[model samples]
Target: MTTRTASARYDGMGRTGKGHITTQSGILTDQYYGFNTRFEDEPGTNPEELIAAAHAACFTMALSFALERAGFRDGTLETKAAVKLEQSDGGFTITRSDLVLDASVPGISPDQFAEIAAGAKANCPVSKLLNAEITLEHHLK
Candidate 1:
């Protein structure tokens, strides 16, 4: 089994707390995240954006492999995932993730592309991991 890990450290409490995140690959070493970064428009990363990035990357890679398995060799795929966080009765909850895909695959019909993209969106690890609603919109280029 393949497992990736990341760590987050938070000092202080509540809005005054400061947090740093680190990834196993060191791509995000000592990355800052906190109330200002999340609730306010501070210059730092936050959890929602990180989840979005993961979702986008996972879905795009899944689509690429699915396409190759279907005998398509060359193509380009770009995906953007938008994650929404809302205030729930208890606290805060992640409501949904919306994915937008721009794709260029030669000799692919709309119906075939839709089928493959839907499969990838449904089966991607990140998508399966989330409890929130997921939606996908794709454009053929």
Candidate 2:
């Protein structure tokens, strides 16, 4: 098995706290994230944004491999994941993740494409990992 790691440090507490995140790959080094960034629309990255990016990438790659296995050699797939964090009676919770896909695959029937896309959405590692509602909408171009 393979594992990836990331670390975060926070100074202070509550809404005024300032946090920095660093990843094992160093793609994000000391990236800022906190109340302002997460809720106040200030500049910087947040956990939801990172999750969306990971979902999008993971779903797209899964779809590509599924297509290849189905005898498709050339295609393009673009996916966008929207993660929603909602406030409830208890506290805040991640409610759902919506995936939108635009694909261009030569010689692929609409039915086949739909089947493959659905399979990918259901089986992608990220999709399986999330404990939230997941929905996928796809279009063939």
Leading candidate by TM-score: 1
Q: Which stretches of candidate 2 lie over 4 Å from their true place?
A: none
Candidate 1 lDDT by residue in tens digits, 50-81: 99999999999999999999999998999999
Per lDDT, the best of the predicted structures is: 1
The count of backbone overlaps in candidate 2 is 0
Candidate 2, 63-82: lDDT as tens digits: 99999999999989999999
Tell me the lDDT of candidate 2. Answer: 0.96
Residue pairs with backbone atoms closer than 3 Å in model 1 (clashes): none
